[model samples]
Target: MAQLMTIARPYAEAVFALSQEANSLAAWSEELANLATISQDPAMAAMIKNPAYSADQIVSVFTEVMGENLTKEGKGLLSAMAGNKRLSALSDVSEVFETLKAEAEKRVRATVISARKTTVEQKKKLSAALNAKFDAEVEITYEEDASLVGGIKIKVGDWAIDGSAQSQLNKLGAAIAQ
Candidate 1:
């Protein structure tokens, strides 16, 4: 996964630069998402991996499947990746692009899981706190997981705040056993 991400970083950065220059970040985001989805499809994966199929064949099939959805630049990206046999990196590229977009827009995505559904007031307060903590606009998604027992866990990117009762108990158990 890390290697794929590393391979994708350059492509994502180049695409992001192009998108910024063209003022088509949102459009490219959508196109990249579609391309990623298409690339991940089992049939498409098989075709891409099959040595019997040439790069041109793969590009033609992908273009046909995307139909009129792809802009000229989108087609160009497809051709470049296909020519380089790096189509499998599309998903990582999309993820990296989204991360870049979010940072550029000063926004962050977080998921909050609690033992019960959060009240509107609680959600608003948490969102505000997250925004203040990150110094960016927070886009929060709330989920209820009874297994958490109580409190909540907040996940933002690679970081997680585990404040649930279950987590506390596990920590206490480990400490006592030690």
Candidate 2:
């Protein structure tokens, strides 16, 4: 996984730089997401990994499938990846690209898991708090997980706040056992 990320980093950085220069970060983001999905498809993965298919053949298929949705630069990127046998790294590249985009835009993505559905006001307050904490614009996704029992858990990148009742109970159990 680490090696895959390492392999994808340069491609993602280059693409991000290109997008910045072209003032098309959003377009590139959408395109990379779509490309990552297409590349991860079982059929596409098989074709990409098969020695029987040439780089041109793989790019041809990609172009045909993506059609008008793909920009010239996108096509060029596909060709480059196909030539280099890096098609499988599209998913990692897309992930890294999104991280880079978020940083460039001074935004952070977060996920909130709660014991039940949360009110709009709750979400708003959470978003504001996260924004203040991260010192960046916050984009949040919410989920309801009954297993949480109560309270909520918030995750932003590698940092997480496990305020869920289930987590507290588990910690208490561990301490009692010790």
Candidate 3:
């Protein structure tokens, strides 16, 4: 909820600041992702909610479970969040941080689906073309769907370029009917 964002904003900001200072933005991203993933486990959720557990105990458990993924700063962050009873918001902070990171890097994550896998050369050319078109780095993820029949459909942000065989067939069918 929007109200949760309000509560989580300060925690996100604090983590962002720490990440910047340590020159560990990428590292923090990995650690936060790990934390968020683990927190999603029902068992972990219950442990975090159990009132009998001390904040330090929860922080220790998170650290031990997090393994080497938690750097010193990340561990400190976990402790702080546990102490403040804000661990539930770690996922929100991680999601917001990823958005901020993407914006800062001027990168867009794109999904490209085609009838089959694209060749390395085709991927290179497409990425180069997209980078030139967007004036930013493009991370292209591909999916294969025989249902596409042929051609490729690209979803970039709000825009989609539908160049699939199915679409062409529909257009041809409409023209024949008219």
Candidate closest to the true structure, highest TM-score: 1
Kindly give the stretch of ten consecutive residues in candidate 2 with the minimal lDDT sum: 58-67
Q: Give candidate 1's TM-score.
A: 0.92
A best-first ranking of the candidates according to their TM-score comes to 1, 2, 3
Regions more than 4 Å wrong, model 2: 1-3
Angstrom error at residue 163, model 2: 0.8
Error of 3 at 83 (Å): 6.7
- Displacement of the residue 57 alpha carbon in candidate 2, Å: 1.5
Model 2 scores a TM of 0.88
Worst 10 residues of 3 by lDDT: 1-10
Q: Would you give me the overall lDDT of model 2?
A: 0.95
Q: Who is ahead in TM-score, 2 or 3?
A: 2
RMSD of each: 1.5, 2.0, 4.4
Task: Give the lDDT of residue 132 in candidate 2.
Answer: 98
Q: Write the per-residue lDDT of candidate 2 for residues 84-127, one digit (tens) a residue.
A: 99999999999999999999999999999999999999998998
Number of colliding residue pairs in each model: 0, 0, 0
Q: Write the per-residue lDDT of candidate 1 for residues 1-178, one digit (tens) a residue.
A: 9988998999999999999999899999999999999999999999988989998999998899899998898888888888888888999999999999998899999999999999999998999899999999999989999999999999999889999999999999999999
Candidate 1 minimal-lDDT segment of 10 residues: 73-82
Candidate ordering by lDDT (highest first): 2, 1, 3
- Model 3, global lDDT: 0.84
